[model samples]
Target: MSLEVPRPIDPSLHPLVTGNYRLATPAIEALYELVTRCLRYRIPGALIYGPPRIGKTRAIEYVRLLLARQHPRMSSYHAQCEHKPRHAEGPFFANLLEAVGDHAPHAGTSAAKRSRLLLRIREAAARSGSGTVLLFCDESQRYNENEYEWLRDVHDALDRQQIKLFTFLVGQQELLAQKTALQVAGKTQIVARLMVEELAFYGIRNAEDVATCLNGYDQTAYPEGSHWSFTRFYIPQAFDAGYRLVADSGTLWQAFEAAHHKASLPGSLEIPMIRIVKDVSDKSPF
Candidate 1:
């Protein structure tokens, strides 16, 4: 017996496959508003804290795109913090350099790397019409006290150049604990500069929230000019038959509630986007 060759699938058409898509959600929109307010006031930075797997990182990614579209000329950079047994200045600056698109991140001493990073940021700010630059530090709960101080140094240096630097520190709830720790330790300087503002990112809280996300899949097209949204691309026949992911919102929400009760999980039923995405992509009834 002979089997027909399996058809090729485009990764871009499948978010589950490529993991390169962001949905428009109320939480993300709220986060964008908070960031814009900070930029408007030249606030040093804000802390975006939330529970794990609730899409804070995804919100950051989406908000960065929004920043580019809305500001047009402002420069933005993203650096991911890592869990360090001990803080090392060299690698920390290297991470910043790499995030800012430096060609030789490892080619200099700690001070030299910092100098280059500042130069690049200054150049970026100069190129911008607004003289502003934004930095997003993900996984920032791993950052130690010294890291925050070094960040303050960068903020001060940029201020001297008459350029505004706004940082968005995105991490899990430990970030709040860190902030309180700083405040308790009389590190008012760090708290005032970096943690003045805070935002709590949340997940789907109700059926309406589920519908909003489902609507995104219904409207978002894949492959840059195709009419096929992620939902349609995966189930063309059902899509043509007037089937939409949004129509499944009630069922999806009910499933989440049932599972929460089954597991005896505490707290209100807040469903993480990661879990919803997994369920829709992997086990949707359609």
Candidate 2:
């Protein structure tokens, strides 16, 4: 059956979004890098995993918009876990088909129908020399082990249909936690709730990744403790200034150098990107 979708609102305008993000240039470039790699050769998939409310979904959406604007032929599907859990075999597939088939003459009548349409869509996508098909699932923590297994089955069935297909899953630490928790306690209700294990040692890969990610992050108007690209010292601001410094741009280290006649460190002003995204997006700063 054609799943009934609720009325749509622009997620970009949501409060959690709205000029409330660091540049995340490295992550954005990482996605763009994936796109380039996929078209040239073929990369299976990538997951933009991070902590909850860390702008994973927004950053991904921005990348998707970039793809749509630059490469209209490349197709994409975005499914929110809160909605449309239709179909037994492939719930994720059903959402994928919805975005892929949007604006088409015929939508799917059932999950199987959507699956069939998606195969044809991929074929058409390749022949036309258009955009690639990217299946993005946000809030993936809501997905159960059974749902993930179903997605794996869908990929196996359809992998041969096209030369390249990519599935990007974005979820919080809770997603990983649920699996670990399940392993600890066989059957638990916590799986339905968004939860995941922590990634304690996450940092820049090489010097290149750091440079790119830092600059790409929107530093202007960035807050302390969250938007790292905006801060300079990266230390507890209140300890030094008696209040958190909120300078979105310019180098405070340079000022210190001018005063003390000494060179300051490179990462002296990295406002916590995660913290800024959360706090700024909550209020109507725009």
Candidate 3:
């Protein structure tokens, strides 16, 4: 008997198919723990460094979303660092101010702008009903020594006002190398303060993590109570069209293993989250 290939489903109708699904993988759990530690212990800053395409930015966004749902009172700001030689702090703080809904004109010298930005951040945090503020900076490897020093100054200033400001620097491995260079060059204060906690993303490894990731799609349901699993869509579609790929055998688990293998890197069993998402979305007929 010939099996008919199932027609591809429209991506706009499903979260999993549209690449909008967020799986609570081990890396996400570790990120959550690091953020929780910083908030609980009143830590000033932390570092999350890893290779590119390893879901660092997505994990940060997930944490921010989770915080917004779990703790509505907490305020969070995200800024992307610019790639320029000797990047200054004005644009950085300007991004922060904009994230916090402040439209005040940033006019004055560097010192004056810094003072105004800090005051605006404090006021925004006060209005958020929680004295805790989280500032996440991506592409942090582009920051220069002067920018790091400015961050240290802001951390100190915010502390003096009794606002718990936690800054999370997310970047590649180069960030750690630059920080070490700074520490050796007698700029140990900011480096030391930010080293309170460190978290690294190594991608999803082991069978357990793969199963967890697969289960995320399998258990999730749409508005009509249909599952996100491939078996629930692909196999049924083929069967409904009077074709059967396997007769009551373990095809779902087989398909999962095959996809995992395809997603894994050469000479390594670990599969990055991005790769897994791409492989799954590409293979799903629905």
Candidate 4:
């Protein structure tokens, strides 16, 4: 008789692997809906703002995945904004080039970089079969008016080519403040171009929300085709005995609510996605 060796578990299947895994929560569903509308209407720009650690970035990723699946012919790219003490046109275009996977991003002048950006984006849109592209900018709160002006130039250049560029800004609440500041400064051109639509991201708001998120762990499979879910992977015996994470949602919500009261925290009890995921991931049947 031949002895068989068991396959090693994939580390990515673990809940703590963070970016490697994502659960489709209600907030993500809302964000996806907004993005879908923006693309459907060919909206120039939209803003997604939320408090820090509220899963905005993750939501962006999830939405991107959904968009790719639903609109297979669309092109999408994600770029993270850097806080420069002083914004320059060269660095601005260079950042976009890098985000779009340009080679020799630093080998050109600002004008040349801008040209490259336009060409790359145009080519991408052309190849997408839909003639449209989505640009998601994270940490967009760091962008200044000048940076926006340069971005607007890119948008205009692409528009001239008949390629639709839908820019979505994902950042903290300061993004809203920046939009207000721009409006007050009479920079309506930029506002009209990019900030015409806005959506607020939120954390788990109630026991029902908690249950929905927990249900993802209880039902989502690991290794793409395996029967083992996150909950099952962590507690196989209990899982086989019919235990599920969704059953604990009410208890988790009650504990957090009580803790908020004990600490005298203000406002309604809203738990960040990171905190909720960490709380659940840290627990074990043992």
Clashing pairs counted in every model: 0, 34, 0, 0
List, residue by residue over 226-249, the lDDT tens digit for candidate 3. 533444454555445554322322
Error of 4 at 278 (Å): 1.4
lDDT, residue 192, model 2: 24
In candidate 1 the C-alpha lDDT for residue 56 amounts to 84
Least accurate 10 contiguous residues by lDDT in model 1: 1-10
Which TM-score value belongs to model 2?
0.50
Tens digits of lDDT, candidate 4, 141-206: 999999999988888888888888889999999999999999999999999889989999899999
Q: Model 4 compared with the native: what TM-score?
A: 0.89
Candidate 3 residues lying further than 4 Å off, grouped into runs, are 1-11, 104-109, 221-267
List the global CA lDDT of all models: 0.84, 0.50, 0.72, 0.85
Which portions of model 1 show Cα errors greater than 4 Å? 1-16, 235-243, 283-286
Model 4 / residue 264 / CA error / Å: 2.8
Ranking by TM-score: 4, 1, 3, 2
Clashes of 2: 34
- Candidate 2 lDDT over 155-245, as tens digits, reads 5555566434566666776656656666587543332221221222122333343444434433432233333323222232432453333
Best by TM-score: 4
TM-score for each prediction? 0.87, 0.50, 0.77, 0.89
lDDT of 4 at 115: 94
Per-residue CA lDDT of candidate 1, range 1-286, in tens?
Answer: 1113221354434565666778867788788999988977868889998888898888888888878888889899889887778799988889899989999998889999999999989878777766788899999998999999999999899889888888989999999999999999999999888888999989999989999999988888776467777777667667779999999899989988999999999999987777777777775322
